[model samples]
Target chain A: MDFSSKLLEQAVLEMSQLPGIGKRTALRLVLHLLKQPEMQTLQLTDALSNLRTQIKLCKNCHNISDTDLCEICANPTRVKEIVCVVEDIRDVMAIENTGQYRGLYHVLGGKISPMDGIGPSQLKIKSLIDKVREGEIEEIIFALSSTLEGDTTNFYIFKQLEGLEIKTSTIARGISVGDELEYADEVTLGRSIANRVPFESSLKS
Target chain B: MDFSSKLLEQAVLEMSQLPGIGKRTALRLVLHLLKQPEMQTLQLTDALSNLRTQIKLCKNCHNISDTDLCEICANPTRVKEIVCVVEDIRDVMAIENTGQYRGLYHVLGGKISPMDGIGPSQLKIKSLIDKVREGEIEEIIFALSSTLEGDTTNFYIFKQLEGLEIKTSTIARGISVGDELEYADEVTLGRSIANRVPFESSLKS
Candidate 1:
């Protein structure tokens, strides 16, 4: 990590600040940039700077967006009355990629992790409550990961909407479609049995 | 991978172009940047843009530098008469970390690889030859990797300097110090034996 040039050292330090990147990987990446045409670096810098400066959260869903309303929330064809609550935009992207869910999304930005000082108040919980109380939303789907913090956040939000007459549901947790039954974890295998769906419903595409 | 925002998609695309990064990792990094203050992104962009736009290479050794001469080439204590030729700045850094070699370095930029459309002429071979012909250099250490391309580049330079009186040697190829004998590859084990040094020389720290 002892870069001979101060500029190189600064660049490597900034690069390594990324979540999983280390000093060695940062050096490798910076050196790779040095080898490529300056246009590549310029493009990357421009993209990053522009993203930081110009990006906005979707006013309705709290998803990262260039406009006040995100594309999904703005689309009239999407089921606006049915909202999918997700931890972040990646979850939104993952769910969108499946093309099965046509509902709008509400990004919580993160889960309720007291260890990390993240809690319900820091999230978009109040905004979500406002949306639910507006009376148009019929169903709210909880799509957070099945982690401890995820469950805590889900329950916190569910309790807030308790007095309201809206239906709330969570994403089904079970063995992956192609995974062998024997390889499935005990908790998931047991849940799949206890919450077994109608045989005909499983036959749907 | 269908990002709702064009800015996000472009940023992710540029980020993923880095070696060993992928679309998912890129998204994670971009989202992490979004979660942080704008200052972090600005700092990163400024560093990268500055590095790309203002960085220079050493005129003598072709290493990335802020000035015409890199630190090693400008140092009076490092032996200018003994040069360790390497593939790139990373190799130079690796050797420098050892603190054993007290000589200047000539960065080839890359090894000769016909498959990659890189040849001797594309490298800094001519400048290296010019340095040798200046007649002050007494030893030229071939410190390139032991890959086929590395060997090809080393041999190409060796043939060029065949008539010169300077000493030439490759870094030793052997099983690593702590590697188990049973796990050592036959080629490396054999080469280590063939190129064995004096037992007393090995004992030197």
Candidate 2:
């Protein structure tokens, strides 16, 4: 299309590469950004750039962070003896929003999907086991989704933690299912977290 | 709801300020951007900043450009005698995409509307009239949306050019209404442009 100078087209092309953004929407966004003050666009661009450059996986919990340890892990008030494990940073944000849980978080990065060639080793599972093996973590609450992959990942973690004195439990799956932690409103997610079931208790006294 | 990390929340707030973006979509977008490299975010931020600071509205057509005269206005081959008047830069893009027209353009900035307190005086209408008085222009095509406001603006321009011994016309109404030109596909818009009619040709002797 005969558009104004090539810069407009360049901005649109870059935006269109983002997930869920189509060409039309991208163009509209570029135009809208053009209408904004230069500072706002610069801030957004810097944030996106920092998301990749300044960020690295937290060695403790595997969450994206500006430092070796995520802000959640670096905080002093957070519970150090209990780590809530989840599939991604979005999940961490969902749990954090509730303000009901005070423990630190472990971002698994993603679930184990055999078809996608993902398995226990591909994720931060080894680091998770190491964290638990250090013996300070008294309880581990699993907040993964209830999809088949979620269950598989959970059980794998459960098996890996076997015979360890540390208590292990999976966050209740009653309110959430499939790849939907992103959509589970706070109340439902909180309820599930409160009702977490101990893996050892399920086997009997 | 009590959210952690004010920066992430701020990002969502700013994204939702866009014309069509909503809260959930903005959240998804922020998170997606977070997953990208810092360089990408920086580029977007830089582009946005540059979009406002470095870019200026072209002095002639009012199409956005980095210079006083946009690339379109500065180009020599485009026929200066035929001025295709459009409502905004988006229309300029639409006409350019077809690669059919070889005329210079005049972006009216917006159509006239008294209800919004925008009138012929508020727009670049004076500039348009000045062009007509110069006596070199043979045809002025109103490639604006066909609507009450568009037609109203067209009539206002037609009246301004009264007895100038020049041709004044409007883009066809077969495919446009109420500023819906932004949503129209290229083919329909192109056809409408090709089938335009003179404003008062039917009334003239």
Candidate 3:
């Protein structure tokens, strides 16, 4: 679209570079900023700039952090022996919100997606293997999504830990809580039935 | 939802302030930016900052511009005597894209909406009246959306120019082009019938 001002055009172009935002949406967003107080724009730009320049990753788990270590990795209450392997920090946040598990996390940054040119080396798989080799973690939980890429990454790491003396398991897949049984997908329903847990164990949770 | 890093939280908060963006979408956008090269974030922030700090408004029509006088106003070919009054710069761009209008534009910045605490004084209405009083413009066209606010704003300006010798007209409102007549709304279809032009006039366009 033709823009009267080069500044507006540049801003829209940069905004549209973001995932899911198209040129029309970018224009609307930039125009919204233009209409708001100048302080709003200043605050937004400052926050983004600070995040890019000053944000740090946890030295232990590679999760986004303000310091050298993330809060979860640094907390003494969190279980260091049982590490949960996941795709990224968003998944970590999701599990943390559930408040069901206390295990520390090892953020893989992303799954092994060959279609997207993301191999095992592009992820944090090496660091995880190194941590396991050091004998720090006992139980490893594969909490990644149940997609093909997720399974590939999980299997790759599982193969690497073949000789290690650590227990490995994947998160249970089933119909979501509060969802109707009929609405569950075929693969998930089949898995849920095949890997059925004991009735008493379900009551315990 | 809880964020792992304060910088991430701040960036998400500022991003969510944009219209139609919620916390979830903000987090997704921020995470996408984090995964991209740091230079992407820098460029986005820089462009937004530059636009906010350096963008100027046209001295003639109050449209966003990089110069005192906008390209449309500066152009000798555009008709200075016929001015299309619109809500904002987006409308100006939309009208310009038609390639039919060779007239100058007068951006009102926004319509007078009492519900939003917006008054005529907050808009560029006074300057438009002053221009009409100066006898430079011969015809004033109201090309604003057919909303209550748009109509109110148009009437308010029409009253202000009541005694002026300039001709006042509103853009024709009807069913959109290529829209099925059966699906057209009652008001628009009625307006189209009530304000029907000659068949030869329609054929000419």
Off by over 4 Å in 2: A46-59, A64-78, A114-122, A175-205, B1-3, B113-122, B175-205
**Mind listing the fnat for each candidate?**
0.84, 0.43, 0.93
- Report the lDDT tens digits of candidate 1 across residue range B32-113: 9998999999999999989988899899899989888999999989888899999888888889999999999998999999
Error of 3 at A121 (Å): 0.7
What is the C-alpha lDDT profile of model 2 across B59-137, one tens digit per residue? 8777888778998889998898999988888888888887778998888878898897888877888888888898879
* lDDT tens digits by residue: candidate 3, A65-168: 99999999999989899999999888998999998999999999999999999999989999999999999899999999988999899999999999999999
User: Mind giving the per-residue lDDT tens digits that candidate 1 earns over A67-116?
Assistant: 99999989989988899999998898899989899889999999999999
Among all candidates shown, the one with the greatest TM-score: 3
Ranked by DockQ from best down, the candidates are 3, 1, 2
Poorest stretch of ten by lDDT in candidate 3 chain B:
B196-205
Give DockQ for candidates 1 onward, in order: 0.82, 0.37, 0.89
Span of ten consecutive residues with least summed lDDT in model 2 chain A: A46-55
